[model samples]
Target: MPIKYIPYTPNTIEGQAVLDNITRTKRVLRYRENNEVYNRLERGMPYYEVETVEQVGKPSDNLVIRGECLSACAYLKEQGIKVDLVYIDPPFASGADYAKKVYIRRNPKLAEKIKAAETEMDIEGIKAFEETMYGDIWQKEDFLNWMYENLQAIKSIMSENASIYMHLDWHIGHYVKILMDEVFGENNFVNEIIWAYRSGGASKKASIARKHDCIYFYCNNPDTFEINTIKERQYLDKKFIGTLVDENGRFYVDTILTDTLMGVIHRVLDDGSIKNYSCRPVLNVSKERLDYSTQKPEGLVDLLLEIASNKDMVVADFFGGSGVTAKVANELGRKFIHCDIGINSIQTVRDRLVAEKANFTVKEVKDGVNLFRNPQQTMDKLSTLITGLQTKVEGVSNFWLGAINDSKLGSVPVYVPELIDSQQKLLDIPTINRIINQEIQNLSITAKKVIVYYIDIDDEKELKKFIKENNATTTDIELRDLKNLLHETVVNDELEFSVSKEKEEYSISIDKFISDRLKQKINEFNDKGNLQAINKGKKFDPINISEEGLELIELISLDCKNSEGEWFSSTEIKIDKLGYVIYDGEKSKDFWNGKITSKEKPLRIKVRNISGDESIVSVE
Candidate 1:
């Protein structure tokens, strides 16, 4: 008997999680209005300047929003956008950091060398550096607080009849299951469809290798909601598994009855065993592989979409990793919205959908603060930019993000909200009180003062007056606006390219490229030989840049008709990991020549480097 109920309900604690937790009745947190989500929304939900208006085969209303999903959902809710079906593979809170293997583009000499030799087909040979997409590290309390708000944000834009499938592993699924129950109500719970993967490997030394992921399904309206019956897919010869159809003319498979997800979910059930599902992980050689670590298989999403939605319905995935949901939805004739905060994710999904001729508008979320890439990068950069902020706070709890060593005050505790989270940006009486009396009350009494960084304040005067009246803690407190400490830390890499005309063909040759940041990262990596365990004693190979930095270019696109505003790539070329040029819609086995010819008269051109930093030049 699997224990579906935990005696200790996850979020049931009355002020058990955090003072700023969200419940069904209380959706908003303490002055969370100060968070960037509300701050951006208050600006009249301004449409993030359009990055692209991609129209491939047919005109589609699909969207790829490049920003935090919570903020994007807020914008969608404000814009009157309603989604009928949603599937989000959000962070599992597994305390693991996922990184993408960054490959350096090959120089022309190496390209020629590889093309000349038949054996040089390995693309992983070009592992330049690893770029972390996002860190899933979180404090359990903060995680719950953030998730409660995230669910509320997502629920705001969902239609009355909308259904949501939340994909998570055993790590924190059980806890969030309780959350879903509270947010969507236990009555709307449809099914816990377990996505059991094909691969299964458990270890005796460690715990069983949990291979399956749990997908909790919920609907806004149970009375009207209906899940379409999906049968085993037809074979190449168009034969069903059972070769049988019911009176309603729907195919059915008699042998496969279990709707389960045992292959990957690692936790032991009450019976001390796990179940399995039929879904398989996307293999590297499969066409579904998008080179994104967090990318899900199309088969999995396809099954879910078919079950939960009708054709041409509005589908959405807030935590859209590599755009699998959007891609599968587009293929199935459904309008889609793919939202992710990573630039790489946005670009990858755009290319994937564009190849299929899917239409979508790419929009950027205007996070006025934090000029850095994403939350993880922003936090990491803050660790260095903040002068006296100490990183080592092992003894202190998560409430105190870090300790600032002040010469006058000694070790002053700092309470900086994780910028990646949309939950804890605002500062008000409740939040200030929590910081002073509740959470940080446990801070070391020896600390002379505490520093709190807030993105927004409900009312600074009111808050200060309240704090002055209610300062019960022994240590003094100081409030600092998180935005004030932020300075532009992003490096703008230079580019050199030329355009020439040859009759109908306008040849755009990228002569050189430079990314001082990538070069610096490589130097730091080589200097601080902190290689993974597998390469403990091996000699580390240093990435050498040629005088002409043409090797840095990974992708090139041309917008022939438009020079500004919205961009639609009429012609484009991409350098795959194998160092081969995928020109327009075709991939050539021959190596790249560092020059591409476009038929459309080039108005503005965009070039993306191997590190995923894009720079554009207008054709004069």
Candidate 2:
């Protein structure tokens, strides 16, 4: 029988452009009101924000932020700290069950029972209860939105030479891959490494058992990410072999030079020859060894770090389930950031890091940033940090900005702006366009002219009628034909109008309202083919801090099961600048105001202020 072959046809401009738009749009959506807190990780000396800075390292100076990864990413971005690498192992979403226990009432005995029930179910490995509980807490749309928003912030915090590895299972891996391609360009796509592990779950029905996970590796820029050489020991033998030969003219083990002090050699029974040789070069042998794991091994990670690792590389992992990447990065002396909404997974990662003795610091940034330090007390002001870093990584940062900004429109418009560095003259946008388009461009329709619709009404009925009469789809119109349909009207937020535009031909460039002078300046840079400003800063060595920074001393998580996590029963407490109130739930409803002593774990105990000085609060 002859083989019937089929060829893949990629999306084109003549196809459904709406789908194209959907594909191009970043998956992350942010609630602006909630994302503004991402601004103060290490920007300044926060203690100077007031006269006195309280030292609350009771749990330990080492801290770990315990919160949702989506919100965490935004907060980290606002801090303006550069991350070197990120690795996360998120839910595979392949119907695998994850469970956690929650106390429903104030009864400790009941809580224990519930906890025991939860534990029993987990031990039994039942999926019913877990699915039921988790399903009610999250929706598909919510997950996708949260994923997108965090990915946005993740992109912002990475250093130029950084790389990110996102791990996923079969269910959402494909969706995440497509989203990743859009966020991190197709050009930046590095690898889709399959992590094959031993003793995975079994598929007892009609299908084969599953045994592997997927890891998507992407870089901020080509040739900029880290790559390290894999290492192998030189030999397997523990004892050194001698270079001496037997008197019988055969190479054999001999100890003629065993006694250097006596300078004597004892004759062996087999060969009655006394050898006076005392000076012989020591002999050594070497052996080669290879790592034996199908999935990413420590050796692989080590190699990647060696090659792609850079100073302050922010590695982000949206999955962050096992925290393998983060763990490896930490061991190899690299910075890491991980994200996942799964509370159990977060706790597992924290525990694993603790067990591994990883040294790190964590802080919860409300909105998208934390007030790590005040601007006046900062090594440099917030603006200074932004502008200074911006000036240095402007080229890389601008490229990202342009890519993200242009994604909203069709393509990044061809424009000219002022040149900050002379080396930019060598850059070829056409080449960039060619490279990017080869991987993701649609080739169906071109924009002959831009028609600004000022109103939310469609007078395109005539155009539709014309298209209907012509027996053609609106997407089939040629560039010449497109000019004839050009019309303008003012539009509001809600309207029913459609543009039958195809993906290829020419991309449309839309600009929001900006001063003509600014546009003109940008145009000049575009026309002149200006390049991004070169980074000029002194390279500093990585700080060596003890493991004290990464410990999770004690956390005071709240519980308001019948109400909300935000609402607590407290009357005698006052809200502080940080918006937190201290209250004694067991005793009186009295409260005190002070910044959290540590974020590794929260405390519910009230802190008293004496002479408005935290020193008065005894360490005990």
Candidate 3:
């Protein structure tokens, strides 16, 4: 006999729109997977290797990557890395903005200047501030498309025996349930776990007070999936009036037994009565609190990790807000990879893990772009372009010589022109003369030769006259097209950082941060009509560097001597006023002292800037 299949359709127009939206998004995702632009981006993206502490005998290592969740997951897929468990706490699309409280140190000299400037002050002699962390504002269609694409990428990296947990709330939980069905298949749906809490704040209007979040659990394959049975003990103190003792000296409550299960109950409930339940009690503030707005409790993640994964298995969390999943997984002896776009989120995780003496590497994935392909304006951009070119050339062979900024081909010093005009102009006489003279003066001990790369020459007559007139007895200048020499490829720039220990206390600082992608983003904002300018420019300022680049910093946190996975903040610095203190590192000497331990052990530092960008470094 032949079977017939029927397609389900919604009855209402609004409902139909929802279905059409998801269907359209899935098609677009497939289209992008095959698109040329995306293909090039995937090929040219950079991977950074940060510092990490390694255990003496352990083979596996933990990871904390900084990038968009979708891009990060796609990179993982391309690298052939698979995980046994996945858990995500993505934005619920609740149409709200989240902010972080900031505190700045109070210098007496600075306070006097503030008072002189007629700024108001509180009696505490410090200032408090707030900075927006991330936003959850999205059009319904856009939100659905974003979630669909991310879920698709996530599915590509899951093993056949893996399970995934999607955490959501009242805002878009129902819609995501349907989306999950499409991605993981309808037959793989397992359970809808409700996490009820009592942090009461609800609308005073007509709706019922919401006190729970929904976690949808699904597996990659129903036949091969593995899950451990979780059982809780019910004490037989007083509730069971009619208690009975079994042959093994185990006590149990006597209840009406069914004929089909009479023997099963006595054997299973040998000691304490067992309860198979789903709802878990809410977490109290006293148990564990990181002050993160959307942070999840460790106990909640513990239960899920216990049931879904085992020791030495790979676990992952892409929307790693508070890093609770990584923390719990590490405690359970499971390997973890956590990715987050927010700087504060990354900083929180790094500081927490470092204090617990957990060993892990921090890496960054870059979006591909050839910054030197066009006219360069800023000195920073020009420097970055030179560095990129140097890396590309050195990988093939030792074709270039000298250090990055002062590189040369043999004895000939190379010079790249910086033009600001929209129309590519020819190399001017004065620019050529200046380059020749500078090279002659810098390398005065030896005869010098100059090679300049340009897209166009203003005038061949002017260049010839300058070269002939200014060319010294032992010097020669030549011009070449840059396009013929440079081709885009995947590059990884490893940042340098140093840690110093004094009297058992450690201090860390970054030597440099290099990102051509970040520079491109800044240039796009400076120029009008770029789409990202309309999107991300509204929130963050373009990249800027000064004396120490410290002005761009937002927060710094540390984890000193972590032995377990539990993250405890050893010290944190914020760009606000509340962090100010007296000589004892407190508002008053008599107040509670929360000083970091001065012990010689592994150390980690997380640095976040005002633009919501983060970088982490560690030393063992």
Candidate 4:
């Protein structure tokens, strides 16, 4: 699929003026309360330690959550769960869509020439397909309000001596630092660490190349907080020239290098136990790479953890992209909590921690965003379900999705609650009051009607009566049930298999597995424009699916339970990027071909595709 790469930067000089004015005044970040983001905590449903499952990890009380961290923090604060350290890399309000590269699994049934060529091409560009994981697009003022709420919620659950690190790039780091100062207190502001990397695009001669990301660190209480001055040999570069070896026959020297990371390039020791690490991006050839988009290097997290926290202290990462924080925390003997808003992130982290034998429990919040698919797909489907709902409109405020034009009524502004955002979805008194007091005043003066869409309403009769009693806008107000407008067909992948009884064991034979989503992605890939393929400077041979859809299977597991309530992996096999199998969480190459035999009775089987879509099949 062709990716629409949109570069994000400040559009007008007015934005610079606004920022400069804020800097000239008091050191604080201010923004419009666009959607009443702080009210989301009231409607948030908390979920905690629902159940434990059998997985490949050691026993510990660590957690991996698949929901919004703000809600999770609310629950943690109520339960008195205090975190000593936090390192989050939240979205930087960039108007860009991020995608993950999907690879086609190698097939033994295919010809040797095709398999060899495919394996060679896997080193770099031109993978099988790609799918959007999430979009980091947001309005400038609205993003600040959202970040402010998150900071307040996170501060409530931090321990007395806790510390936090907020990672950001050139987009909005300066503004977020001011917000951090307001929430954490200006006196508690500790340090701002600069991590220089070479991942972004080089400058085009018109401007200088921007490459570093700022990490704003703060303490809950500077008086009680004690940060360790972690020793590194690189800072001793000039000192090594005038010093000699100590009595232990060992000397430390900061060796200088000119390759990358200009400051304190390397280190050396007389005992040959040299330890050196550069603040860099995760390279493709690095062993710590999991191919997850926006994944940060482990060394980056290590340096922060070493300075801020100690062993056994609770460390939390709200924007846990790929679980690098949780994995490193567990490795460093610290308890951790990993939370995010994407299932793909949860799955990626789960598998990584499992492979490392790190103990953690999986969790999901009971927010209304719990849907059949992810939030991105659900949001995309809303456009088709709601007729004439415009997503973009000029001069019309974003407070409304867009003014839906009606033949009878000239223009009606539509208000739809975002499924991913829990704070603004429920149509309650706060939502209604905002519409009347805050939003209505900003909308186009010509708009005579306003429509509000909602999944659940708080006291609909009272709300309708409330709107009638406080009709200040003189606009025809209508409340529409969001679910009532849903009219879409659904299809599921068909899974067919067989189970035979052997000597005190059950042997499961995979007959056929079909995935609709994967097939659709392939079709979209082949439908690329001719000019786009020509830009490749080589012939683009289309991929044909002839293996009965076996190439789509990335994971297979049997939850051999008598009844299905909670999922448990009794026997499992996962195909890696190189076509190797991880049987029962054990990596193996050229194992028992396709047929998997288990000594226990198979109850149900779970299959996951290479695109991270999963489905379950019952054998009863």
Candidate 5:
């Protein structure tokens, strides 16, 4: 299938941007294939070691990764893991934010507090209770660029007979089809399956209602692609009631039947004949619906899986929204890999697979580890730690103020060393010296002392000589060890909680919860100058040693099964203004009650904050 070309004038800004991004994508792909090298196994490095969550039979068969799809796919390619089938339900560039509706358990005290805060809670107030799951809002040019990069990364890990199904809607499907042709080649293009379904309210503004999503299927090699002929059973009881039986004792519909039975063949030995199945949208709610907005039915995924790949073949879904693809693949006994960027997505998929007793390993992959070391990762960690400390600190911002050269210490200019000269290769010295020169020149005009943070100072003599030679008599330079700062920050930043048991019920009291990531977000909101958001962020204290802190918790799920096994949702405690959990046949309960007898096996508990961050605690 040939891709339809859309004309664009290069003089226009949007057109120029799109063209530029396409050129850049080609260059990036080339550079990555030629220059980038990675270490497959690095201890203590993020994204290397796969954490064993629950082992069923073997650890490597089923996997769930929490990370960006592009990097995770790249890592998979590095590990020499090839997949037979890939189905991605990527963002549709719909220019809207998606949120999940979370219900909280309510008690009389919370109800009274709600009443005291407002006379009556309205629909908007209820909406305020919802948690933002993921955002699909993106500019057209940016969205296309993102999709192109991800597709390039994903294509590298596809096997020779692999087939990919890209699920999308009317929004950007056409544009993506053209991009896919560029990446996967036009000759490999297969089918454009239209999944039609009906749900929700219809828009009266448009004459025609948008009721279907488009799924573009492509293959690595069209001639050698793996495919199975799936058949749908045509009921013969209703149509062949008065039909004659053949010599083989089977009901026969004449081969010369009407054109309606075009592709169906007349068989002799069976009660019913089978015909090639047609694609249909999943209209009815499936039993696997977890209220995820972009969730697809397992039947739909099953059909795709059955047609494109066989049992025991490897399958992967990079945009694992609700993990329907993984769940369906698990049921069909296929090895699978599922990856997603959202924390809530990981939690939802983890809980779903655990409840189904599916064994899988979880891993977290983040950028910053390369063949050559980069200071950005360590600097980012330090920034978070510094911003999270609640006590008085010198010139600490709630957000990461970029690197030392570009960042500031309050109103004063600051220069942060890019690397420790002693620990790295000699090739990096010239670059370090250039950066030092730039920093010295920038700090020459300021009266404030320049503070440089470093992990080691093996080149201290040389650095001191350079500073002394460049000093203008008015400026002073101060050096601080990065390790000491990390230690100080770690000592102050800690989470406190206590647990008590009463027979089968367990109660957990959180003393405090502090996170630099949350603080950084609040600071970013404050930077945007949103007074309302800033106020809310300031009062955003979620965990404390009181019942009011419990109100901030969205869900607390317990796993009373084998602690070493997959975490099954044995009990859940949710808190909402008007919601309640039945306890001993009584509603409006505050504490969690687990039906567990022995805590000797170790208990696992997952606590989710309002912002969708999940913290798993193991109790022995």
Candidate 6:
């Protein structure tokens, strides 16, 4: 009996495994204000924004709403924004620095400590704290857990046929792969691409310095996504020895044969000599063939984009650290949404987009607006707004919703109102005429400042008549002599930097909170150790503190531990201007050598033995 190759189907028992691979979550953060969501939509109102904000009676698009990602995902689902592709490059537990001089917090308490350390260190306060607190200890598990929580939200928002590319490195690549298998179903697992790159720097002391990272590709269901193929640069094993041409206009080693115990014979072809053998179950082709890079190349992104099919497909990146996937989507004319908790990652995306001259519209506003606030209030306000306009306008544009019948805002999709075109005779009515006339007046007034688009015109006469009837007076309105104006559409990509600046204000506040907390913690440690008084005469060198160490302190209180992996009793050690160390008896010995001494250099104090030797060694 011959074995038949069966195509993988997502509907089968095996297929169900893929869909069931997603992780489940119980609780997600909810916001205190609905006004934030509302205000955000209003403030950043685009002339013709993307599908996310292009719903009926949406609030402001100007707000930067941060809440439970799961909740936001729920709203997106309600909006009918089903993602087709998701690429998450979330935290890999590499302790890679994130954001503006801060590392992601593994321990909430440690996060609190780093915040406390920020004040006394001044400009170097946060740095100082990280050096003291997290200098030695690296928390790999906490980072992974934090990342997984966010990924749960990402997974929930994807379509059944969607694909995900989770980028990782050696740091925690293997662990994440296991997690992906568990979440995305083992059968749904696709390829593990090793993205190789060449670096100028050589790895001298170590075994082959790593120059590549792992990108795991998985689908919600097996064989449900688009696969893009590329042409090989050249043919493999060109056995075109002696004018060997086939009907297909290609050359091949026409003689490759072998015989098996089943009485099957096979032939093999060599350049000048013939080779044949008899085997149990004979095989014919023995030539090794190569087409392109066995490993997926960097161009993999372009190929994936081509397979996506839909022009306005939703492409999400929850682990959007470098943002290559998003950038590729944008370049390929696909709409993308990306997010990362890391400030540096977000900044990287922003910079790359801008540098590529990718078109984007952004608006910023203050935080108090509460855009993604109470979901109920948003629904109520939207109801009132839509109701008030129902009798006033003719036909609501469905450009944003495409064919989706339902889309939610807050937790409810905008109620799609039945639309009817205003009758020609209705233009004669004063009340109806007044609204039309007002719109025309507003259009005429703003035409010079912005592009004026006219739609639904068969000829010049209709255009002129419509304009005259509505009292629209604008030099920019091209009186359509043809039917093309009927299909007129307009979009805008203007940036309001002021809105961005205002949005930055809230982030700055968050930053300050982190700063204040770090400083406070540092002060507490200093006071407990009685190092504050000694600081009066001591000159501190900035270089002694490592950037990573300070980050750890800011993230968590720099709780120092001893050589035995035990928390050391807290005490104060003071340094004089001449770099003299003073501690209460053995307390000073704990930091410096066994005795208090003066030195010109800043003492290197190791904390927790996370990195080098010593829990907290002071060097001068």
Per-candidate local distance difference test: 0.72, 0.34, 0.55, 0.69, 0.55, 0.36
Error of 2 at 605 (Å): 6.2
Off by over 4 Å in 3: 1-18, 23-60, 106-126, 234-238, 241-287, 368-620
| Model 2 agreement with the true structure over 1-620: per-residue lDDT tens digits | 00111111122223211223231212222222355222211111111111111111123322244344433444454445566666655444444333322111112232245555653212232111111112222234434444444455567666777677776667677777766776677778777766555444478898888766676888788765545422211222233465344444444444321111111123243344432311111111211111111123443444445445644444555555445556666675665665543333344455356446565454332321121111111111222322112222222222221211223343221211111111111112222222232212232323221111111111245533533453222222211121111111111111111112234321111111112222332344443332322233333222121222110011222211212222121122322211123332122221211112322222122211110101111111
The full ranking of all candidates by lDDT, starting with the best, is 1, 4, 5, 3, 6, 2
User: For each candidate, what TM-score against the reference?
Assistant: 0.81, 0.37, 0.52, 0.81, 0.57, 0.35
**What is the C-alpha lDDT profile of model 5 across 223-308, one tens digit per residue?**
88757754443335433555655455655444422212122233222345443323333333444556677777766777778768
Q: Tens digit of lDDT per residue, candidate 4, span 446-546?
A: 66788898866778889999788766777878998776553241345777778898789888777777877678768878778444688877677776665
Lowest summed lDDT across 10 adjacent residues in model 5 is found at 1-10
Q: lDDT of candidate 6?
A: 0.36
Q: Report the error of model 3 at residue 553, Å.
A: 8.9
- The parts of candidate 1 lying over 4 Å away from their true place are 1-59, 116-120, 200-206, 233-257, 261-278, 393-397, 400-414, 438-451, 471-481, 484-487, 530-538
Worst 10 residues of 6 by lDDT: 38-47
Q: Candidate 2 regions off by >4 Å?
A: 1-63, 101-146, 231-327, 338-360, 365-620
Candidate 6 lands at a TM-score of 0.35
Report the backbone clash tally of model 1: 15
TM-score of candidate 4 versus the correct structure, residues matched by position:
0.81
Record all residue pairs in model 4 with backbone atoms less than 3 Å apart, i.e. clashing: none
- Residue lDDT tens for model 3, 491-565: 332345566668757655545445444344445544543455577666433333332333334455566656444
Q: Which ten residues in a row have the lowest lDDT in candidate 1?
A: 1-10
